[model samples]
Target: MKEKEILINWMEEGMTSIPNVLLKNYRRLQLNETEMMVLLHIYSFSQKGISFPSFEDLSGLMTISSSDCAACVKKMIQKQVITIEQGEQTGYEFYSLTPLWNKIAALFESDARGESLQQAMTEEKDLYSLFEEEFGRPLSAIECETLALWIDQDQHDPAVIKAALREAVLSMKLNFRYIDRILFEWKKQGIKTVEQAREQGRKFRKPANTEQVSRSENAVPFYNWLEQ
Candidate 1:
């Protein structure tokens, strides 16, 4: 036979479409090689309009015995990976892969959430290191708890917290009480970004009624959040 004729014959033999996710994650789904092959055969048969192929039919295409094929199908049903339902109109039993697809989708969502949590933990660790470096001392347990509360309870952005720390340092306060006050004030004012914090500081530092507060020539102007 010519190559073209062979190719045409192969094309006419038809193809089976399987989800890439199913192929990649079959092992994770707890399907062994034989079981996976059985599922593939069932799917192929279904594509050809065989909704429920018998154990003999399944065994014919596989190296396993008919009894083994039946056992595998029973195990899959027990695992809730596949289900058999009777058609209402036709009254014929058919296999449904909805449970398997749902399991795969749930696994993907769980993996995404796990990745997000891991990223959040890494960012929190870096933020803690930055705080320790700026303070020139390790954070006390209470200080650590306070920082966690800011991120978890108050939902303060890490960048905004860093900006508040900068404000405290500029004022020569360099204390948690001062920094906490700055954060509280910012939150009350609905300030959520570094630019908004800077703008707030500028507005507060602007001289009122042409009366400037006296300070040393080298002193950097900083918002005294305690007085506010």
Candidate 2:
């Protein structure tokens, strides 16, 4: 293959990665904001032909457990956002995205109602500033509100929200939406104090089964989603 052809071939894995400063806008279903964002990040990383990151790699990079990553991958497979297939040549798993939404929906689909998510976002005027200050990037307005709804549950303290954001940025390697999910998790874990969070992190980091821990780490998210 010529250089250009080689580059093209490497990238033509039929892997459809949605790109942008606002890739999470494409997310849907009952997924928590973090799971949705994590799916996008994983898909984007795989689009570069990186293959799947090892469990340790994913855990460290995503600031979540390997099992949580695996569970999210399973849900992504269920959603048909991505599909995993055993590789014919390498005897490993390969993955691909199905709907070519950007080209298809972006061209043919129009919301004549003028009352879609996009419009709602446009109306939430201060959303971008609030999101960018927390996440280091602008969030379309409705996403900001969705995040706000999560973070504001039970307690609506701006200080709490800001502190959660700071901790997530430092420890989570998180995209904007994940701050909400982590806060939710923290709340459920009774992690109201810095000492509690430190203890929880240490407990989770203890060495465990290499196989099971890397496959389906969290059931709480699924249960919580189901209850919600």
Candidate 3:
């Protein structure tokens, strides 16, 4: 009798898809534009089963010079965003983005398991400390309730809500109403993660949103937006 072997081949499978977390969080990883583009191109090629791409092959598809691509590739390798290995097909060097994806996945998992606003404030995260760090004072009771509401009723991810708070602080618009407005807009757009919220923020500079932001700055009754 002959022994049978089971094999699983990714190339035999269909289209290559990237995770949303990776796409949106690349900026958080501190990847520059060139490194991001280089990693993306390599990913595209790998999806098409092209294990190895020459510097010329990679640079030809973009307006960047081969030297620039080479530099970016080197940076990506150093940053562990990509890894090079000898492929079995031809024993030539190939690049892989598994390292990058692993880092992205770990981040998402951590966020998923991380504490909620209330738990963190009372427990390990010491969110009160964080709030003090940002606001230069301990959070008031109503402010604490607002944070809890953002976590509980709104079901907004805690990290995203925290990020919104940081954004409001940076914009000099720190207030419960302002933070609520930010959460509302994000919820309207179906943004559930910090990465999605961050990505949207990058594209959120428009006149209408600016007007809305101005309105959000006006003193409204606490939690009034929830009723509206």
List lDDT for all candidates, in order.
0.89, 0.57, 0.73
Instruction: Say which prediction, candidate 1 or candidate 2, comes out ahead on TM-score.
Output: 1
Q: What is the full ranking by TM-score, best candidate first?
A: 1, 3, 2
**Model 2: per-residue Cα lDDT over 75-156, one tens digit each:** 7667655676677888997655544244335433444345555664553334446557665666777866666575345553
Candidate 1 segments exceeding 4 Å error: 1-6, 193-219
Q: Where does candidate 2 stray beyond 4 Å?
A: 1-18, 21-24, 99-228
Indicate which candidate wins on lDDT.
1
lDDT per residue as tens, model 1, 120-199:
89888988998999999999999999999999999998888888888878778898899899999999989999999988
**Candidates 2 and 3: which is better by TM-score?**
3
lDDT of 3 at 212: 64
* CA lDDT for candidate 3: 0.73
Q: If scored against the real structure, what TM-score would every candidate get?
A: 0.83, 0.34, 0.45
Q: For candidate 1, what is the TM-score?
A: 0.83
Q: Could you tell me which 10 consecutive residues in candidate 2 have the lowest summed lDDT? A: 219-228
What stretches of model 3 exceed 4 Å from their correct place?
1-16, 88-90, 116-228
